[model samples]
Target: MREADRTTRQRLADALRAEPATPSELAAQFDLTPNAVLGHVEHISRSLDRSDERFLVAPPTCRDCGFDDFDDLLNLPSRCPGCKSEAVTEPTFTIE
Candidate 1:
């Protein structure tokens, strides 16, 4: 389908299926805010629950200590619990 013919959520799902990408990356590609991309991701994830495909998230990690375990996997934390670093990478999402 043409890009203009599809909904925002549908475009987002198609992007994820192509390759894993962070919210920031997707936001820029789709011309939306990171928060907006997150919202689309949440909806797409729910829709995929019944399908054989899976919505996978490579959780955010701290640039300082490389910590990837956070209480909330979707949102980016200001500080890393392991290293207390302010530099944290946003989680990458992909459909597998």
Candidate 2:
């Protein structure tokens, strides 16, 4: 992996160690796009040693629109329909 990618993974690992953050939270914390943050997390899991054992965690996702879950104000969709709006209020964990 490149040095910058490694650094980003390290930072992500540190943040995750500190707290269980949704992808969007990490994105906001680092001023990255949500997709970018998810990409980082995915890359981190792929490149890190013991990834299967330690980095086998995924961020929460909205049941409604199948949106990647977040802790910030904006990422949360008003509602979700994939799983229905009612399910939208809840978060499902994705590990893959």
Candidate 3:
């Protein structure tokens, strides 16, 4: 299908298939907010065919302390637990 005919979710899925992406990267590419990209990622994940494809998420981490153990993998954390740092890395997503 032509790019113009594809939905935002479709384009986002295509991008994921092409390579892994952070929410920020996806948001910038698609002209959407990071939160909006997360919403689309969630939708795409739910809609995937389990037999043919899988949606994978790399958990968010703390940039300062490299702490990857987050309580909620889906939600972007505001603060790091290991260190009181606000520099948390965004989770990465991909389709495989």
Candidate 4:
């Protein structure tokens, strides 16, 4: 990535570190479109490549209990198969 892009990414990460912001919030903060912010996040996730960071982009989660899975929780159901809840909780990437 270019120097400017790197700087932007770092700033974004810093902002996220302070609080788990959704993509729309980040975009608005940086005067960028939501899609652009998402692109930057995707790049950052790939660059980190840390085993601990699992649901960086496509937030993997249970498809039944509406449970959220992040760096903290790794073992989550695939389809809420046990409960048959089917109330999957998808990650909120946008503030609104």
Q: Evaluated with lDDT, which candidate comes out highest?
A: 1
By lDDT rank, best first, the candidates go 1, 3, 4, 2
Candidate 3 per-residue C-alpha lDDT over 1-96 given as tens digits, one digit per residue, 9 for 90 to 100: 899999999999999999999999999999999999988888898899555899989999888889999987767788998997999988999999
Reference-based TM-score of each model? 0.92, 0.53, 0.90, 0.50
lDDT of candidate 1 over 1-96, digit per residue (tens): 887999999999999999999999999998999988988899899999999999999999898898998988778577999978899989999999
lDDT of each: 0.91, 0.57, 0.91, 0.57
Which residue pairs of candidate 4 clash? 64-86
lDDT of 2: 0.57
Give the poorly placed runs of model 2, Cα more than 4 Å off.
1-6, 49-53, 58-96
Give lDDT: candidate 2, residue 61.
54
Residue pairs in collision within model 3: none
1 versus 4: better lDDT goes to: 1
**Which pairs of residues collide in candidate 1?**
none
Worst 10 residues of 2 by lDDT: 87-96
| TM-score computed on alpha carbons, candidate 3 | 0.90
TM-score of 2: 0.53
Off by over 4 Å in 3: 49-51
lDDT of 2 by residue, 11-74 (tens): 7777776666776677778888877776677666666664654554543456546665455332
